[model samples]
Target: GLPKSMSVLRVNDLVLAAYDSGIRRLEPRNGYSPGQQDSQQFWSAGSSKCQGWDSQGDATYQVLVQEVNASAPQAEPYYMQILKTCELDDATGTVQIATRCSLNGEDVLHYRGDQNRWFSVHPAAWRVAERWNQAAEVFGAMNHLTPQQCQSWIQSSASFIAQQTAQPTGHMALVPRTEARPRRLICHVTGFYPRPIKVTWEQGEQDALWEQLSSGILPNGDHTFQIQVSIELGQEGAGPTEHVCVVRHSSLANTTLRVTWDSQPTVQTVTMEIVVGCLLTALGVGALGWYLRKK
Candidate 1:
């Protein structure tokens, strides 16, 4: 099964709702304030599910909430985080739930669902971890509720996930060389989703085996990805050769996207040639007119 995860983001004292994977699944307009009707419905559903889980055992989920509120520090500039991840081992038919907490960018506590225990990540956090572990409600939910939520969300969002992929756009350009480097042919692919993509330089029918450099896949502000692969152009090449940049991505699985680049005259070079040709033609016509006048 594919790995699944959920994250709740908080900044300072304001608590926001959770997200499935990276998509914003549920969030309120203001801190704990009622948002849209659908968002409230979703939150209510999750709360009811928690209550149902609490009914199955002696520990109530409210204990976990109260413990969290009581454990929060009163100091300013405080930060808290909770991350839950679930992974399935296909070979053993086993699922693992990993839950952890951080404070002020430092790991403070972690829960071992397999062992049914919460442990301090550092010696300084031992007291805090021990205090929180006393609330059996938290660990039980971390152990059982997380995997179920992960699986159910994945199944329900399968079609939505498939529609999320964004196809990449690619282009090729010849860049001027520096004093220490040779000219380069750069292939850039951008605005792609899912991040996993292949950008390679090819010469005619085969992969270009020349020395190349790559700007590894980088995230765009809009959540898409981009990459650039470049190969140095050597002076030893006899003539212009057609080179192509090939991009392979899940969004373009059915077709390979290619952007081609070849040696072409620069705009300045073409402009200079046209100016010189015009000047030569003017000089030749003037000379012919003078000879005809002399005749």
Candidate 2:
């Protein structure tokens, strides 16, 4: 049954909730120089139907990329494609490499290479094709680039931006581990470029007294970065439950950002649950005492 108040939910909210419960969780224009216009790029490559029990069986593979707004300097994105074949099926193997120059979604050239030889949509692109072939940069190019390597560019790009371009911003949160394990206080720092950054847990203004549980820096996927520094709460925790996520990054020159979390409904909710449990236990004990007295 739905709640009466929940009837007000917008259609979009219901649809999103369904996906979120299961944990479900375009391009830029062309430019004169690489910097003039915003550009968006996507590249993905993978293989399917890898196992073939017999020579008569053929496996399938592919790589697909849809790109927009790469018109100038970067207009020539090096590309090469290769396919291998033999007279007998048992002896047959295939190679595919594709790289190209593009403008406004139009192909400047598509270079498909076989062996060391290459052919291009534009004859002048042959030289670039040869270079890509020699370097063996291809979609799903097992020899030159691995599937992991092909897909890692996006993540690496984020890491690069975090380490080279932005500054760090941060805050702290209470992270409750398993009930049996120690709860931890975490300092989260994100969105600073030039990822050479540090986050420490501090009490008041004094230097951090406890060792940080290193939660390595990770990319936030928008040319930004994030990292977590944590400390486990022991039986006899030190100083204040009040703490700070001390942030240090290139963006903040001679400055550190210290952020704190609110003690909100989280405290109220826990207290309420404890009170309810205690009340239920008292009722049970009273019921048992009455039963014994009646007997």
Encode model 2's per-residue lDDT on 1-295: one tens digit a residue: 3211110100100110111111111111111111322322121011111111111111101111222222223545432222121111214333344333332233434443334343444434444445545764442332332234423332333332333456675545565658676767666566666556877776766766665687565545344556667777554555235667778776888888877665423644544643553454455434323221222
lDDT of 1 by residue, 1-295 (tens): 3113333432211223543433324444223433233656777675555344333322422333234446564455433445555665647646677666554445656777787677877455666567657874664444443666655544444444455678998656566668998877767677787778888877767887778899676545444667778887765561125677888998988798987654446645634643554455455434323221222
* Backbone clashes under 3 angstroms, per model: 0, 17
Query: Model 1: runs farther than 4 Å from truth?
Result: 1-40, 46-78, 89-93, 103-112, 115-123, 126-145, 173-175, 179-183, 234-241, 262-295
Q: Count clashing residue pairs in model 1.
A: 0
Provide the lowest-lDDT 10-residue window in model 2.
7-16
Error of 2 at 36 (Å): 9.3
On the 0 to 100 scale, the lDDT of residue 195 in model 1 is 72
RMSD from true fold, candidate 1 = 19.7
**Model 1 CA lDDT for position 246:** 85
Clashes of 2: 17
